[model samples]
Target: MNLGELEKAALQYFWSHEEADAKQVHAYFETKRGGSLNTIQSTLDRLFKKGLLKREKQGYAYVYRQAMSKDAFIGELVADVTKDFFKPTENALHAAFTSMSSSLSDDELSELETLIEQQRNNARSE
Candidate 1:
């Protein structure tokens, strides 16, 4: 899904904080980003409509939080971007991961390897 700058910033805020009303979000962004409360409210509404945020009415205002974790959002974005061009295959996926991992440090690469091994073990059990 496409996201505006404010939308992305608002999502970041939700990821870091538990939940917030529009005014609180505006307060957080007022100095750093300099947008009005209406803008913040609209951004939150848009995010809620897009299913990126969960909101429920609290008194007269809505309190919002992220619908998914940051990693899940990123995974969806990666899948969305790659879906059109690639007919995913094991080798293709491996190649893509290897290419992406090229910039990783040794420790990060080892962590990735451990995760892969854990996935393999899980799959075998399943």
Candidate 2:
């Protein structure tokens, strides 16, 4: 499922905060970019339609929670990007790693190396 920028932002907000009401989401976005409550509500409704969000009636307000975990959602998004833009090629994966590796800390790089070694070992075993 393709998510618009506003829907992605709303989902991220709910993911980070656990749960949020429309008013709170509206205020959050308004601070970042001036938008009416209707806009936020519409985007949230769209997210609901996309099955990315679940809403519960809390008193007079609706509280929203993410339907998918952050990691799962990110994995799905990455898979979609790889499929559509990268065609699942080794060059695409290498480019992504190269771009991201520059930002990795020493510990992160060590962990990545370990992960690569483990994967290599697994491939050999298979």
Candidate 3:
């Protein structure tokens, strides 16, 4: 499922904070996005089914945690966006990477370089 704004926001919130129950998430939405408790609960369920979250039993309620980090989530989104929106061409990929790289911080850029190096090493080994 494509993560619309609300779902994406919920994931972002979960990534920054520790695990939370549906009621707690609903309260967060009430303060910010103003959704009902049931709505938040439904959203959480949807996220769980989408493999974005893992839920654990917490007494009468279930506490949910992120299944992936924010960076991993963004990477998946970027890959999906690339496949769905861009043409299958080297130039398109190059342009997409260039556009995205300009917004990265120095630390993020360093991390990306490390990832690319690892990818290259993997390719050589293969």
Candidate 4:
């Protein structure tokens, strides 16, 4: 998700729905985010060119779909971000996490703990 705002919005639109023409995407922003049609179309086209989206011609318009599943995309992002974030030290990450953890719900903290335990177990097994 290290993309520009319009690119992120366009990707989110693709994530929640099936392939759509640029016009459909533009219409959504026109109502929801209130951006111009050209902006939406340019974002979609840029995403297609960047290999983040699949595009196919349907009669006159090109319909676009996400190239990868949202889960996969997020997993890659998390891995990349963690690699960068934890490059300094575990203590730094811990301090940052502690500061941010207050904003998370109890269920979210529990789930994160479970995931951390799972990763630790997997690492030990490996």
Candidate 5:
């Protein structure tokens, strides 16, 4: 899936903030990056349509929140890319992690290892 610059920015905004209406989101971006409120509303609507955001109509306007966490979104993107080239076998997954680990710092690798251990434990319990 391709994301435009504004779309990516909107996703990041939703990830950071719990929920926001179009005006609130537009105000947040105004000082940092200038954009019209209509543009921000369009971006939010696009994200909602893409299923990256959840929205509820609150009286006069809709308030939006992220449909998934940032990590979940990244994981989905990784899975999407990996599925195109590999069948998702254990060896393929291991190779992918090993290659990706080359750029990670020691602390990040440790955190990754912890997450993997948690997943392993969860799988065992299930």
Candidate 6:
């Protein structure tokens, strides 16, 4: 499921809040971008069509929740991007790691190194 910026924002809102009404989502976005209620409604409709959100009737309103967990959705998104743009190449992985490394703390780098060693050992065993 390819999500647009607004869809991503909407999904994140639902993810953080557990459940959100259309009005709440609109209000949240309004604090940032100041879009209309109709705009928010349309974006929610698009997210629903894309199967990224589930809606349930709540009184006179609809409450939205994520159709998938955040981690699962992010993993799928990363896999899709890798498959589409990187052809699952080691060079792409290297670039991603290098880019991430620049932002990591010393402890994080150490942890990543340990993870790499574990992956290498697993590969050797395989």
Q: lDDT for each of the candidates?
A: 0.91, 0.85, 0.87, 0.84, 0.92, 0.83
- The candidate that wins on lDDT is 5
lDDT of 6 at 40: 90
**Model 4 steric clash pairs:** none
**Candidate 4 Cα deviation (angstroms), residue 111:** 4.9
The TM-score that candidate 6 achieves is 0.66
Which of candidates 2 and 5 reaches a greater lDDT?
A: 5
TM-score of 5: 0.88
lDDT of 4 by residue, 1-126 (tens): 458988988889999988899899988888877988788888988898877899999998899999988877876776566666665546555656687789999999999899889999999999
TM-score of each: 0.87, 0.65, 0.72, 0.65, 0.88, 0.66
Clashing pairs in 6: none
Q: Which stretches of candidate 3 lie over 4 Å from their true place?
A: 85-95, 102-126
Give the Cα-based TM-score of candidate 2 against the true structure. Answer: 0.65
Candidate 4 residue runs with Cα over 4 Å from true position:
85-126
Q: Give me the displacement of residue 62 in model 1, in angstroms.
A: 0.3
Residues 4-117 of candidate 2: C-alpha lDDT, one tens digit per residue: 888878888988888888899999989898899989988888888888999999998788889999878886776667666675445666666788899999999999999889
RMSD of each: 2.2, 4.8, 3.6, 4.3, 2.0, 4.8
Q: Residues 12-124, candidate 1, lDDT per residue (tens digit)? A: 99999999999999999999979889999999999999999999999999999999999899978877776766775544555567789999999999999999899899999
Q: What lDDT is reached at residue 72 by model 2?
A: 80
**Collision count for each candidate, in order:** 0, 0, 0, 0, 0, 0
**lDDT of each residue in 1-126, candidate 6, tens digit only:** 666788788888888888888888888899898989998999988888888889999898888888999977886776666666665445665666687799999999999899889989999999
Backbone clashes counted, model 2: 0
Residue pairs that clash (backbone atoms under 3 angstroms), model 3: none
Better of 1 and 2 by lDDT: 1
